[model samples]
Target: MRLSLKVWRQSNKEAAGGFEDYKLDNVSPDMSFLEMFDVLNEQLIEEGKEPVAFDHDCREGICGMCSMYINGRPHGPLRGVTTCQLHMRSFKDGDTIVVEPWRAQAFPVIKDLVVDRDAFDRVISAGGFISVNTGNAQDANSLPVPKEAADDAFAAAACIGCGACVAACKNASAMLFVSAKISQLALLPQGQAERSIRAEKMVAQMDAEGFGACTNTGACSAECPKEISLENIARMNREYIGAKFSSSAV
Candidate 1:
């Protein structure tokens, strides 16, 4: 199939950026979205032109690095799938696709289709961990976790930190990503020690990172490749409130 692509091109974070169009031929329906880009890049390179730059790793979709806002949706129009997992069959022959990077102050573009997501790492560093050493691995039966909590924790842990939540939000909020991180731990007994402080510090750091405020719009969850639930955001709010109250009571 042949297709037209309007992709964002930026030399650097400070450089002015705009959409550049290109036509691609011989695209296979089975080719993943990134593979299509690879074909385009190869064609440009063969012509001695600078290839379009995009982020991708572990093309199997585990890395969450294939971040392309395609046709105004993060990771294309698919549900519960990342850009690396999106296939060209989702489009039609002679179609025009618009692709852009994640748009958020905290995720400034470093180059074409690549944004600096280190802000997420900083937020995680602020409190997303359990510092308490529980020693070596214990028998699974030794600490029997409630089945419901274990399931919920596992679901929350599926978050790949793709920044789709931030990209999908009207306010560019990272609340969904931050909440999933908090919930994955807060629901597990292993994360109990840092519960209150985790919520406090992470939320503070999220704010400091210039991420926008969440207005309870469900766009983030709807677009999240993991489909991380809005309930995690609610849980995070409760955790933050409880932490603040506990600190003030001291």
Candidate 2:
């Protein structure tokens, strides 16, 4: 259960960074990837060395904060699994693992294995919402949307903005994330009011954030934890084109 870890070490965004090797002994195959990191950090602290800096808000994988590039794959080698949920058993004994942060210009390195993802916040702030003045509460079944649309909306809404989409893309595109958000609204009755405007504003903001364009590589959906489909990207394109042609967001 022992292995060598080659982890990225960077003091700050401007600082030069490189991989530092460490030997992890007495490791348990049952341990989660983040738990293995905790063991490593404890050992480093005992030796009066600064522990590797990584993000993990909820180690249970619900918060999407446990973002990392494990052995060149976002959230480790497993499909549809976040780093916090990745189990050490996935790797063989005596394996050499390379860990790093999400590599993208928009997602700058905040420290070792931690990148600033506030660009996602900026995109969300750019009209990823509805504006109708519906005075709050309504009947439970008042506006029954079609079941298929509801399912599609729910599927698209599952995106957690982990940026695995960007990390997996050759050009580091955020289209999957953006398109997921756009499709979530475009497929639902509640989101209809702001659909067109939302698509336009979010797309503009995504470009402003310096994210690369989608080239149909399909890597983003493959790496996505929620398995956000590429169909959402197509839906977003349709929404954006339709919005540009319309005078109003109707």
Candidate RMSDs in order: 1.3, 1.5
Estimate, for each residue in 1-250, the C-alpha lDDT of model 2 and write its tens digit.
9899999999999999999999999899999999999999999999899999999987776687889898888998888888989999999999999999999989999999999999998998997877666587777699889899999999999998889999999998899999998888888787887777788999999999999999998989988888899999999988898899983644
Reference-based lDDT, each prediction: 0.94, 0.90
- Give the per-residue lDDT digits (tens) of candidate 1, residues 118-189: 999999999899875568877768877999999999999999998999999999999999999999999998
Relative to the unseen true structure, what is the C-alpha lDDT of residue 106 in candidate 2, on a scale of 0 to 100?
A: 95
lDDT against true structure, model 2 = 0.90
Candidate with best lDDT: 1
TM-scores of the models, in the order given? 0.97, 0.97
Superposed by TM-score, candidate 1 places the C-alpha of residue 24 at a distance from the truth, in angstroms, of 0.6
Candidate 2 stretches with Cα past 4 Å from truth are 132-136
